[model samples]
Structures are given as structure tokens and as C-alpha cells.
Target: MASKNLENFLALMAKVKGMDPTSDASLDIMQDYVTPDMEFVQPPSFPHGGVHGGRDGWRHMAKTLNENWQLHISPDHMWDIPEEDVVVLYVNMEWTAQKTGRTVHYPTMELLRFKDGRIARAEIFPQDTHAVLETLNAHD
Candidate 1:
């Protein structure tokens, strides 16, 4: 059951990434996979850099990302900590700065806490914020 839940979460993420962020399909997937009170978090070096709540928060995050960069996210490794009901994922993230056309690639680790098969909280930690920032700033 845990494995199936993890697969569903990963599939939802992939489907969302492939579709237009504002599309009905994407919104539906977000609603299905994320809890209504879910908290989405990003590290300080991330563009938005804070805690965003619920599906609307995801929409805001998508808007910020679309406005600032083009991104590709790939899941690398995933494991579940049943005790905490958390799924830890290593993700490969690549993005191009829309403003400067500069590109950066980095590994991001994410902790996703789940409740009733939906993500209750998601947190992202990039391996090297300085490198990411430097690459984004290169063409400036």
C-alpha cells in the first residue's frame, strides 16, 4: 500500500510537470494528491523561499516558477519512513533562467509527509544553493 501510494504521488508529479500548470488536468491532479491544508516549503535559496499553503499555494508556486524559469524535475531515488509516514525523494532538477537564458542543474532532496494518501507537507532542500545561484547569475 505504501509503495502504491508513493507511485501514485510520483506519477501525479510527472503528469503535472508535463501539463500546463493552469490547465484543468494539472489542477485536478494537485487536488487529488495534495491535502487541502498541505504546506509546500522551499529553502531560503529557492526563488519563492517560504512556506506556501494548500492548492492555491501550489498555483502561486507554479506562477512564480513560470514567470522566472523553465524547469525539469526527475525523481532519482525514493524511500519511505513508515514510522513517520514520510517519503524521502532525491530529485534531479534542472532549470533555465528565463531572464538570462542561463541554465543550472542540481540535486534536490525532498521530504513528503502524507496523510490519507495525500501529501500533507512537502519540503525541498537543494544540495548546492550557491552553485545554483551562481549559474543563474552567470549571464547577468
Candidate 2:
């Protein structure tokens, strides 16, 4: 069950990166994999910088992020918490700015909580946020 849940998340990210966010497939993936009340905690310095809730929030976040960069995520590690319905994932990601054509590769740690087999919450902690900001600023 844990592995399946993780795979769903992986697929979700893949769809987000590989297809247009507003496309039917992308929207369907989001609806099927994530709970309707799901929320994402994002760093203020990041491009999609806020607490985004629900499918609409997810769509808005995708829009904001796509406006800035195209993201490619590579999962490095994943572990399910023993006493809780949560998974911790470490990922290496590359974000290429759409406008400037500049890219930044960075690592991020995310805590995901699941409810009834659907993702309910996610909190992201990016390593070297300053470096990401610096790279984005340089291109701007």
C-alpha cells in the first residue's frame, strides 16, 4: 500500500511536468491522486510561494510555477513513517526558468501525509533555497 501510494505521487509529479497543467490528463491525475482538501506548504522564496489548498489551489500553483520554470523531479529517497500516515521523500530537482532559460538543480525534502489513500498534505523543505533564489535573480 505504501509503495503504491508513493508511486501515485511519483506519477502525479511526472504528469505535472510532462503535460500542460490544465490539460484533461493532468487535471484528472491531480483529482485522482490528491484529496480534495489537500494543501501544500511552500516556501515564500520559491516561485509558487504560499499555502495552496484544494484542486483549484493546485491548479493555481501549477500556473504560477509553470510561469517561472519547467520542473523535473528525481526522487532520491522515500520512507514511510512507522507510527503515522506519512511519507518522507528526498528529491533532486531541476527547474529551468521559462523566460530566462536558466536552470537550477537543487535538493528538496518533502513530508507527505495521506488520508484514505489520497495525498492530504505536503510540506516542502528545499535545500539551498538561497542558491535557487540567487540563480533565479541572476537570470532576471
Candidate 3:
């Protein structure tokens, strides 16, 4: 059986999927799955600022990403490391640029921190970043 935390996490993940990547997903359900003062981060050399703090920051980042490129993430696995207040999700990302018609797929890992049943922080690492961007930019 899945732990209650895991179950809740899955439910939250579902909400994220229903969210339109082109819009404000974080704002739509922030109260349910995100803590106040949450942080969002992408690893070094990320196109966006390395880190953005709070809900507003997340929204801005998401909007920017959507405006620049199309993204799809397929979840493969998730682990609740409650002892560390972290959840790690394995996924594959497929990106297609609306402008160029180029596409690429890559494995990715999303590391998130949860607090009080909400997300506090997140980080995404995609293995084939060059391929992803090339495809996305091609359409542009």
C-alpha cells in the first residue's frame, strides 16, 4: 500500500498534470500543495535564474519557460524521503518548439522539498539538455 504521504503526493502530481504548462499552475493550486515562502531552483547554467523564491517567483519562471518552449514531462518514479522532507521524481522530458518543428526527448530527475503537505522547493536536472534546447530553438 502507498503511504499516506505518497498518496497525497500522487494526487498533487495529478493536479500538476492537469495544469496548462502555458499558464499559472502554481497559483492555481498553491494553497494546497505549496508552502508560503517556497523556493524554486534550476541547476547551474539553467536558462532561468538559478533560483527564485516564493510563489510569485515560481509563476514568473513557469510563464517564461512556457513562452520560450513547449515541454512535456512523463513521470517514471517518485520517492518520499520524509526523513529529509524531500521527494525525488524520475521522468522523461519531451520538448518540441512551435517555431522550428524540432523535437527531442531526455531523461530527467526532479528533486522537490515538501513542507506541511506542500512543495517548498524544486530542482530539475535533464540529462540531454543540449539536445532539448537545440530542438526547442530550432522551432524558434
Writing each residue's lDDT as its tens digit, candidate 1 over 1-140 gives: 46655866877877787665545567777788888999988776677668988888877876776677777778889997766778999988887777778888989999999887788998989888776666557542
In candidate 3, residue 108 scores what lDDT?
90
lDDT value, candidate 2, whole model: 0.78
Tens digits of lDDT, candidate 3, 1-140:
55445666788767777555446654576547777687888654545547878877777777777765677778898887877877889987777766686877878998988776677888888887677667655332
- Kindly give the stretch of ten consecutive residues in candidate 2 with the minimal lDDT sum: 131-140
> lDDT score, residue 44, model 3?
49
TM-score to native of every candidate shown: 0.83, 0.81, 0.83
- lDDT of all the models against the reference? 0.78, 0.78, 0.72
TM-score comparison, 1 vs 2, better candidate: 1
Report the error of model 3 at residue 73, Å. 1.3
TM-score of 2: 0.81
Ranking by lDDT: 2, 1, 3
Q: Give the TM-score (vs. native) of candidate 3.
A: 0.83
What are the per-residue Cα lDDT tens digits for candidate 2 across 5-34? 666776777767756554556777778888
